[model samples]
Target: MRDPLTEKPRRKIPSRLIEVDAWIDSSLWRFGHGFSRFWESVTIFSRRFRARGLNKLAVEVACEGLTLGVAGLIVMLALAQPAMKLTANGLPQQTDYSVLFLDRHGNEIGRRGVMRADAIPIDEMPDHFIKAVLATEDRRFFEHWGIDFFGLARALSENARAGGVVQGGSTLTQQLAKNLFLSNERNIERKIKEAFIALWLESHYSKREILSMYLDRAYMGGGSFGAAAAAEFYFDKDIRDVSLAEGAMLAGLFKAPAKYAPHINLPAARARANEVLTNMVQGGFMTEGQVVAARRQPATAVDRSTTTSPDYFLDWAFGEVQKIAGDMPHRNFVARTSIDMGLQQLADESVEYHLRQFGKTYDVGEAAMVVLDDDGGVRAMVGGRDYGESQFNRATKALRQPGSSFKGYVYAAAMEAGFKPDDKISDAPITIGRWSPQNYGRSYAGTVTLQTAIAKSINTVPVRLSQKIGMDKVAALAKAMGVESNLRGDKTMALGTSEVTVLDQATGYACFAAGGMTSNRHGILQLFDTNGNLLWDSKRDMPPRRRVLSETASAEMNQMLSQIPIIGTARKAQLSMTRAAGKTGTTQGYRDGWFVGFTGNFTAAVWFGNDSFRPTNKVSGGGLPTMTWQRFMEAAHQGIELKPIPYIDNTMPERKAPKVAEEGDAPPPVRPASLTTAAQKVLAQIGMLMSSAPPLEKPEKLAAAAGDDNAVGRR
Candidate 1:
């Protein structure tokens, strides 16, 4: 179809058409252009030997200089970019450790991310794994002194053949040098700088050491950096568990994890892993048998846990442990805690159940609980009455008045100081100075025994007893018993005018459950390496000692508190448990309700309060907190050994206490003439009083008045 004219050689241009083609080639044309430019740029006035101002030598020198300049230009194009120099003052290590929550059984209940370095060691990695890595990423990793001239030559030659630079020849050291020290700019300058620094690094560190550091610090994808972390993320196994295939899979991901993740495509991942395995086997880093073993099984996964989700218990424990143990990341320590996951779950459920009851009965939506082991180990904790509303740890942080429950402390102190539970104290209009404490019903139960007063949470009785034992000593006694709060100074302190956090209150009661010894409230027990090497061992366990209470003192307190259901305040907590002691508390205006109790093996405290600080409509500890406490204790005590309170002999004749008042200028309560016999008899038998006593009539005003005191419970 071509025209005859086009197909024909258009007139063989006079002969030697092929010679013209050869003359016009790039090399020949370049030389011809240079000659033409040289001739065009030349300037001559006359014969060089005839010049007036210049001699033949000067002319020759100028020509030689121009020729040298041309030669320099050719040499410049032939050289390569040189390496960079190393410098110190590099960035600090980007080290991070995570925090985890574990139960009493040593199971991880919950966790925070960034706890990856718990296992794995770089030194244990296979040699073949390293060689395979070097072959795939940077073959000249060891051969080059930070740069490879021959490789550059080969690259340039290949690029010339292909028409552009297609692949680079960066050594591993060069990459590390760039990754750790230089900007990721793709240019000759950056590459030169990378080369220099890599050479400096190789000069300072051995090949093995440098390789180890690189593996420990390099990014390995999946949100993990370093070989150990990569191993855990992909296989849920340590570096020790890594076989040839697993190691290959890990090594393969360093270049481009996004393009090859096991989760996204196991086949591609496995194929790449196999390639790595082949490299390892060929290189003699691992035997074919090891590779087979790794391939025999799929990657394992970490154990699933209930603490997986954000939860009230986890949140509370996370913060509480930090408070007690100091701020620590999960990797910073291997902590053994005292929590019972089962009991914690049970407590969480109970809190929900009890709060639901309030939702039905009182249309309320709140509850909280704290359970401790017999040894004072915090086992199960619930912060809010309703987790749906908030995540605040009311068990440890909430500061609320301990209504009638406060009465137990007062009575325990009084009974320990030699006051008998049967001795009567008159409640007939007795005033010390200006204050007058009232009973729960706002009615006087004249001549109530100390036991009955505490049993019924008789507010006036404690005030009268404080007058006998001196409230100062009572406060000291409470503080000594782990009631870390400053006791109330005013007469209302008898009615819990002071505030105490649920933590102290709960642990304070745990003193009794722990057999009168102090139970140091803490969570962390030991810190160890993932390999079981001891790092830090916490031996600050607060043991139960006589610091708890005299068995007799604790026993009498328990017996009297037991009457809380039969003859006193906490009648609602009469669940079918053999041995239990609890007291209900309701602050003034019902702003707060509390139920703190103890069994032989466990101590628990519960509180219900509104954020707005408004009084609940007829809400008492018995109604809501009791339900929560009972449920929590029921489950928290399931596997725990439940026994009776230590035997406290209460048969001693009632010891008469001296009428007392605060130090400094304060008047004492006066015994009226009309009520003298009744007052003395009641005062003489202050331990025999109860709600059954008849109210006495007063003839005149009191003789001694109370001192205006301002003591309050502050922890």
Candidate 2:
């Protein structure tokens, strides 16, 4: 048969004009076959379902769904908003960014990024380049109102002919739409929403705007995005300088950039580039000679910037940052961290060294360190001796019993309540109601001033003061200075039985170090947009801090902390430092050890323990933390001038008569009303025990108390 127009083969259906009619009929048949194949599967599945009685159930279910589905859809639509499309920002996306770190002096100390591109302008882009992209990626890009039904049908037909699903039907518009306004879930509902957004964008903007957006946002090879980044990544040149071959290669990657990256396999990428060039020539965007030149001069370079990952620092710092700013979006965050790379280096080195030293001298090798400036800012922190073996940041995270370190708070509270530093207090087994706390040695300091008791980190003295002033006042005092974690309302907590993280302890102690003014610990400094517009700053309109103690009381507290470095438990921390102060804390049964202290300008708290609440190698705050503090301070303030502190004598009036203990190792009974009968019985039950505590001539039984029983819980 022949058509009248071509005049080639004319034979059969002459009278009926069957040649043109047959062409029309065949096109419709092909279309029908494509749809029928899809629909026939559904019909077959339905027949099998009917055989199993499932068809009746399905019809019933569909009827119910038909009744409620519209209402459910309305509810969901009501719930959905612009923000609902967002989920928690994932770990730093697979983009390589250049980092520039500087000291407080603005001297650059670190560099990571290269092969970069800032941004590209829409007018500067070649029109033919965009046309070629449309030809290859979405042929009807400019023709349709966003989504194209005909293009999708053609794609389905091609896939059917190929005997496998070899092509995707997602237009560039659909992809951009999804990237901007929909979640990336692979389902029909999301695709429908993407189409809606794309249609809206098409209606609101011009063709040039859509094309510019596509060129700017589409991901390219080697952790690059947009035409400009792709150009620099592939050829080490700007977008304006890209050759025809390079341009086509960049365009080819819109489907799967990683699979076609030149660095992954250059020969395959060059072949794809040649195919793109052929398409460009066919589309009349480029000449045949251009294709030949593009193939001849292939890309000579490929970006290798994605090879390294900041695995350790990124993993560690991300957890820390989330503590302060988890609610802030990850996209526009600027954490003005006090993290000094040099100080962090020193911290890592000191943790390794001191634990090794302690491992040799004693059996405890585990350690942690948390350093902060007296400005109420964290400076350097090491949560463990080895972050590689463990990620639990004990410095900022773990909440272990603070042991004698808690005595500092008790002593401070007593001082404010008129217990003078020079006033003498007996440190023996003293019973306050049902609780009795023994020293770490289970011995007593017979008669010593408050200064000597605290200097030696005495446990009994604090227990006495907590009873005299009442545990309510002590807990309130702790809370006032920023120890927001729970503190025991009962007398048992007075001996530091309650658990707290090293960070809160360091921060609470830092308040005293900073002359009694509280500054809430902060991490982020300010934030800016990608375009460098100011978004937020941490220093804006902050509240005035509450004063927790008088300067005179704070000075006395600092005096006790200073004894640690001068003549007490933390003497090893004295790196020729004059104005240093800190306290040592070892938990009951040696499960945790902490050393938290500060000088005039810095406060650092170090802790050591396991997250599973297992014991470490008998480590204490004085063991590794003291040495780490010394090492950090040495490097941190090198050649910086500082002054010495002068201590003053106590001038406050003394409180009422107190309880005193004898040289014995007996515990008090639970909830006793009278001291003699209950104390005697509890001692007899414990086997190796008792004498009535060498009785202080009773002046008065302690007053009744009011506070949380577990006032201090683990931080």
Candidate 3:
């Protein structure tokens, strides 16, 4: 109607203006109609979804999908330029490296290599080494591109089940990409960059070239960067001359460099190498016979170029670092250790002093010692006679017979079973299932107190005790006391026939000084990275104490053992400055001698023996081990105040009611023989207020009530 009227009125205006007006009205009307239809359709769809109870679900799914799509788009855009630039660069240039190890005081104890190991061409490496790497690291190296989709799927499944990252399924190419270009952080951005670089590597280089570059630049542990360098560093041989076992070990290092490091942990390295050999067999890279032969000839790491007193400490700290944070870098880092350099120096000097004095006379070729605080902080360690002579850490790695030093655990079990220190035990020759146990001097005391038996380290007493209270109890007690080695469960175990590392023995012995509170011996108090970030701290990370022995039993055992440094086998180990309790152990054939002792402040263990297990002419634990212990303890406790250990008197009277003070007349002088001076005063003060208390039970009855013994009705 308006157009008709306008046309009639358009005589005054231009005809094109009237035509434009009609077109605008028609376009607006069409838009309005279309909008009305869209709105109606939306309303109908919403009503249907609500009726089906699917509206919220649909909205949630749509929002999640849209968010994921947007995030993926953003990630792609962010990584595009870096990925392109990395692909253009093709390969990263070499950089300098320096790994500093700090002592407890934050002083640099030693520094590893400052330069990267020399790289070699891939064509020069032996086929066995290359095949070992492929078999152990990635069996589908040739079939996959930069990433292994199947492995990734499996890893995702495993991580989801674990509820955290427990597995990393990065391919060799991806590992090369990460090590070459990206930081060692586990995050989305870094992972994306790693994937992109891996793809770039796969596209740019041939398989052989990629393998060559990877092998040349890979970290093979012990501060070695390439396969060639690792071969040289571990075996002191060229890559072409490395044996199958050696090559397998090198391949195993790619998974965990410090864990499988030969110089750091030879047993772990050998075990990992055995795994690699098995992988090679399964992957058809080597025959079963070849693996057996290779295992027979286990690789021996060459001596390190430089050595220090804290070399063993450094190795221990490195292991702790692995436990705290996996996938650590070889260089550009700092590991804070619990090793007290001053104590370490003192221990080293003391070992050398003993070795030099009696090494020739006693036929002692090697000796190791470990010292720990009451809380199990490893303050000092002497791994071997000389680190340059052999890098094998006997203090923590070597497992030899603990001998009579294990008697403490046996006696502790007996004491917990209601046997008192004053109880008499026969020390005559005893036979159990065709096994006769004799004293060290081939003599017997017939009958003696438990204190005397333990002080003299009479073999027959513990053997008979083990027989009385099942060998299983002894084994359990030993394990509870922190002895990690396997026990024989035979009568001979009473004589310490089982072999145990000095660290385990020392840690177990420390429980006595800690009043039966078991602690794990650790050489790392805290760890700091190159960026000064604290990785781990023992104060916050220490595990809960495992109470293995009752306080009364620990005190009684200490009383019996304290005599060892006074009138027992380790008499020479007595410290004039402080009271010490310890045991002396001499193996059957005199192949190993041990002295493990503890003070109120510290605990220590020493081993003296030949690495070849050759018997010394007349070497016994009472001689060299005691001397070394005395020297080290003397130095360690120079300025520390003398503190008496927790001890219980076996001669204390039975349960009796105290005479109470009458009407605040004077507190009855509660003079208990077993109580210390300070304890007596406190008890007297309490006696003044409690005038009609019940009689106190005996120590044994108290132990029974507390379920610390094998009393009837006790748990």
Candidate 4:
């Protein structure tokens, strides 16, 4: 208002604020001078002290010790974070149920889970059993708080002397901590957590309580947990009545259950038991005279070696039960599964026999098989060669390339798009962008019918057909059929580059076996409570089946697939009693080989490969997989009345004798008309090479040629 734009205005400072600012400046200056003087005095004193060599050494050592202590604290805190996240709400409640699984015939096949009632009190256990465990596992159980440093040192010394680990350093408390709150991983973090948990356990529970929990929590193999369960499982007797010899054997399993379980290997179990007896005598818990008798006789487990545990089936069915009754209040359940023990045994034997017979020759180490009834009931499953060595369910869990077997869905899509089995498609090499799929032999057949193309597994035909009908439609049809695995809509989809499980293959093939209806695949047929009250029934709870394919389309697909076991890549899969139809799939590099076939009554999918993903010795679906499928199917179709495949004739035709050619008369030469110029040139070069080379009479040379021939024709 007073010509502010041209005038300079000044604000007056308060006297109290100016005095406060001066005081703060004076205080800071005084503090800085005093600290400087203090630092100078300290520096002179430290230099004087360091002038003496002994004082300097002492200071250096002190600094190093403090640095290490700080670093150690940081590492400890980092490792403790995982354990600290666990709530201190006492030990977790025993939610494990005592599930008793039965086969389709109501036979008790096996048992799983744990029950609180199965726990045996410490005082009730046999005196010798308790002594044996204490002597072998932790001789200083009463001497140490939680971790036994002296025992660990002794074990380390012994292992150093032996140049191999012969004794475990973990105390019983540490083992209990691992079984309770930690995984079996052998990392530093897990070890730290285990030690911390062990200390916590010792602080909260008494010696007797800790020992009892240890005996009840450790896994004792054969799907049994705890000493009480092991005693009953191995000896068929209660823990209180276990004899000294049996107690020794049971104690031996605490170290390595799978390696020393008597049912698995009696010799190894006895050896481990003898070692336990020696430990008892050495620890002064028993006199040599008392243990000698037990060592001589050892222990004899019940004769369960002949009984094959349907562990894979039980594992799968258990998951199904959990899905169906996860919200139920009842903990204990009796699941009647759809597994037929006989068929299960057959499947197991067939897989094992083939692997043992040809596995080494073919360099295939593992195999999985799944069988289902026409109604989608899972009849049998073999996850691997041995359940003890590996628990990963390959039948239901392993995702492998299905190879050419996936062509069925593509063809089905084609059928739905108004293509016929007799529809002609060019099998010549065709490229969609940069991808040009070639047949297995690198040879193309000329214009061929859809049936002939699928039977022969001509790769170019399906790729062309998929491009025409659209891969999205093919993927939708495959999902509708029952392929639960995710399918990619890339051009390679028609070639089955996508991976699926053996169970998925079986389920999808079962849809075809069920006359194109949805395959409501299920494992658990019924669930019952302890009092026998029915809780869930699969027949009532399962969703109704829906139609996935029209009748004409389904029949055409069946007709095309039926040629496989007869004249296609799966000739070995033909059944003696009934007609079989399926597809053969061989992945790139022969890493996986599959034969998924369906009969009028059953559908089975077989896979052969190495668990490590190593390529086999050129094992193809037309070889071992189909052979195993044939073996199982022949045995599975023995007594039951055969059901005909939908829209297909099941009558067995008479076999005609082959006509013998006249002497010195050669058969006419045949050539595929769809061969590309490049393929023809390659064949011409091979012929020239063969004509100029010497006869391949040597076994190795012949084998090499034969191997090349096999690879060229693989499905």
For this target, which candidate reaches the highest lDDT against the unseen true structure? 4
- The Cα error of candidate 4 at residue 705, in Å, is 61
TM-score-based ranking: 4, 3, 1, 2
Clashes of 4: 0
Estimate, for each residue in 354-389, the C-alpha lDDT of model 4 and write its tens digit.
898778889999999999998799989999887655
Model 3 lDDT on a 0 to 1 scale: 0.76
Candidate 2 achieves a global lDDT of 0.62
Listed per candidate, the RMSD to the true structure in angstroms reads 30.5, 27.6, 26.1, 17.0
- TM-score (C-alpha) between model 3 and the true structure: 0.53
| Model 1 residue 701 CA deviation in Å | 76
Better of 3 and 4 by lDDT: 4
Which runs in model 1 stand beyond 4 Å of their true positions? 1-97, 112-331, 360-363, 385-389, 485-488, 535-548, 648-715
Q: Kindly provide the TM-score of model 2 when superposed on the true structure, using C-alpha atoms.
A: 0.49
After TM-score superposition, what is the CA distance of residue 498 in candidate 4 from its true location, in Å?
3.3
Q: Residues 1-715, candidate 1: write the lDDT tens digits.
A: 7798875676566457777777679678899999987776563433434644466678788889999989977654343233322355443344354444455544555433243344244467765567668656666666777677777787688888999876566767776776576644356766757766777778877787667667766655443557776676667776666765666777777666645567555677777777776656665666788677666653432332222222455555545445444453324333456776666666777666655545545544455677777656677777765332333556666667777777777787787888777888877666677876666677887787777777777677788787788777767766766676656666677778788877777877776666566766655554433323334444533343556467677777777776675555675555454556778888888788888887666788888776556677666887677766765665554433446655533232222222212112322122111323245357535523432344222100010000001211100
Q: Give the range of the ten consecutive residues with the poorest summed lDDT in model 3.
A: 662-671
